[model samples]
Target: MVLIGICKYSGGGMQLTKNPNSTDGLLDISYIKDLTLLTILNNIQSLFNGKITSHKLISTYKTSTLKINVLDNNKSYIQADGELIGSGDFLVSILPKAINFIIP
Candidate 1:
């Protein structure tokens, strides 16, 4: 599974999203300053060991916009915020502070 996260909780309580050194929030305006991309391999052994083999592809990248292309012929479903959006290639970008948040 591939996951792009802005801050903690992006993975819904998954240990992969937890960072003790950083503050937990949706955006962590100060803590997590960049978007993180996590790419997981299909190998069960490597995943359990939490190790990165040099032979494998780069697993992470930091960027504002992410472009995904499905090279495989099989149809792949895409989901956003727990909702199924569609299938196929997609580009996702983050607009910094696009919406203002108010606390009561």
Candidate 2:
């Protein structure tokens, strides 16, 4: 079975939510801004145990929608499913249980 859902497409990379049941009608957005290898290693256990938000440097949110816009011209881009779809500004919305999946 392929569990498909919206993920935060950030400069670092794509990431999945800490929990994947998707019952709250909201998306669990997680990210580590200004991240480094050291921080990841330090919190390696937490990350592996599904407690990434335990780190002070990490930020998490549960929202039905997210909006972001880049003020600088650093050639940033928004990607989906491994491809760059747009750049500069982007909006993400969740449809709750609307997205059906085949658990094969």
Q: Estimate each model's TM-score.
A: 0.51, 0.63
lDDT of 2 at 90: 69
- List candidate 1 stretches off by more than 4 Å: 15-58, 73-75, 101-104
Minimal lDDT window, size 10, model 1:
23-32
Q: Using TM-score, give the best candidate's number.
A: 2
Candidate 1 residue-wise lDDT, 1-104, digit = tens:
45655543433443222222222223211112222344433443443333332214424445567777878627567777778888888887767667554534
| Residues 1-104, model 2: lDDT tens digits | 01124433222443435555445677677666777788777776665455666567666667778777678647666666668676776678886678675544
Candidate 2 structure lDDT = 0.59
* Cα error of candidate 1 at position 82, Å: 1.8
The global C-alpha lDDT for each of the candidates, from Candidate 1 onward, is: 0.47, 0.59
Model 2 CA lDDT for position 74: 72
lDDT, model 2, position 99:
68
